[model samples]
Target: MMLKAMTVAGFSLFALVATISLDASAQQDDNLIPNDLAIEAYQGGWRSGGSDPTKECLAHFNSKYPTKRIQIISTSEESRKDWKGHVEYKYQCTAAIKLK
Candidate 1:
């Protein structure tokens, strides 16, 4: 009976450890990285005639990290800015995601 009890306890411990390890690894894989932000603007924050810089950011991350992906978590903020003489829409983004 003692031997059986020990075996059961050992199995339970193993199961607990496995659960925790999986959760921990999952958390590790989900990395919070910056630069996923995409802003619609000119090349120099000018009023208009630019593109999203964050697209390159995400692409770079994808190329640098194998099997990892970037997701736009949020559009953190947005505002209107006057550049030179043009009124442009500005956006601040919060981005995070990863595969490992």
Candidate 2:
């Protein structure tokens, strides 16, 4: 009986820690959204192309959320397309922040 009680207590403690860890990680993870409306700023043939979506998104998140350390991982990015006087580009980025 004592052994069983100890085991249950251990399991409960582990479960509580796991829940806290998951909650912390969820809080750290964030979806990046660029403040600038024009993620792909290439307006016309004469205009220069926009910055890298992943980097831009990372910068935006880092700047917006001040933290000791942060890591940005680009989950996926859209294909780049270009044509005469026209361009279409898009991408997505995610950020994982660490508290130092």
Candidate 3:
């Protein structure tokens, strides 16, 4: 009877340890960046004659981080003429992650 009880206790301990290890690994995976999305802001500029500068900024961000989708949170535009008289556009964009 004593031998049987020891075997059962050993199995229970092993099961407990395995469960704890699996839980820890799952928690670590939850902390990984691939599972989470963080909002990031970027600035991009284009010559005046080009398409919308705000769109240009978003496009640039999408090109850089193709895996992540961008949602436009906000945008600000600045206009300044360069030496060549071409209007330079500066765009400030705040975006949230739409997908991971």
Candidate 4:
């Protein structure tokens, strides 16, 4: 009986540790971007154009949320057209900001 109780206690401790670790990871992810609207600047063409969506996204967010630490990843711009001569320029970027 004592051995069984010890085993149960050990399992409970392990479960508690796992739960805490998962919760921490969830909280970290939540801090990534607070508002979805702020990410709109880098949507659609912005992303396809090879422009780093992070920069445009960060800029948009910074305009409204100056307090947030916004960081943009590498950005690039490219043009691609079909054989029909339909030309379109696009911008893409990725952004990360910390929430207060």
Q: Which predicted model would earn the best TM-score? A: 3
RMSD of each: 13.6, 13.3, 14.4, 9.9
The prediction achieving the highest lDDT against the true structure is 3
> TM-score of every model?
0.31, 0.39, 0.51, 0.35
lDDT for each residue of candidate 3 in 1-100, tens digit (9 for 90 to 100): 1222224645742222222236677787676446457677887745565667568767877897788777777888788887888787778887777563
The lDDT-based order of candidates, best leading, equals: 3, 4, 2, 1
Q: Report the lDDT tens digits of candidate 4 across residue range 1-100.
A: 1222224645742222222236777787776546532333354352334344455566666886798776675455667787987666665565665665
Better of 1 and 3 by lDDT: 3
lDDT of 2 by residue, 21-62 (tens): 256676557536433322222111222357566666666666
Model 2 scores worst on lDDT over the 10 consecutive residues at 37-46
Question: Considering only N, C-alpha and C atoms within 3 Å, which residue pairs clash in candidate 1?
Answer: none
Quote the positional error of residue 79 for candidate 1 in Å: 4.0
User: Which of candidates 3 and 4 is the stronger one according to TM-score?
Assistant: 3
Regions of model 1 farther than 4 Å from truth? 1-67, 81-85
Quantify how close model 1 is to the true structure by its C-alpha RMSD in Å: 13.6
Kindly list the per-residue Cα lDDT of model 1 for residues 2-85, writing each as its tens digit: 222225645743222222225788877786643553322222232343545455445544565546556654443233655666
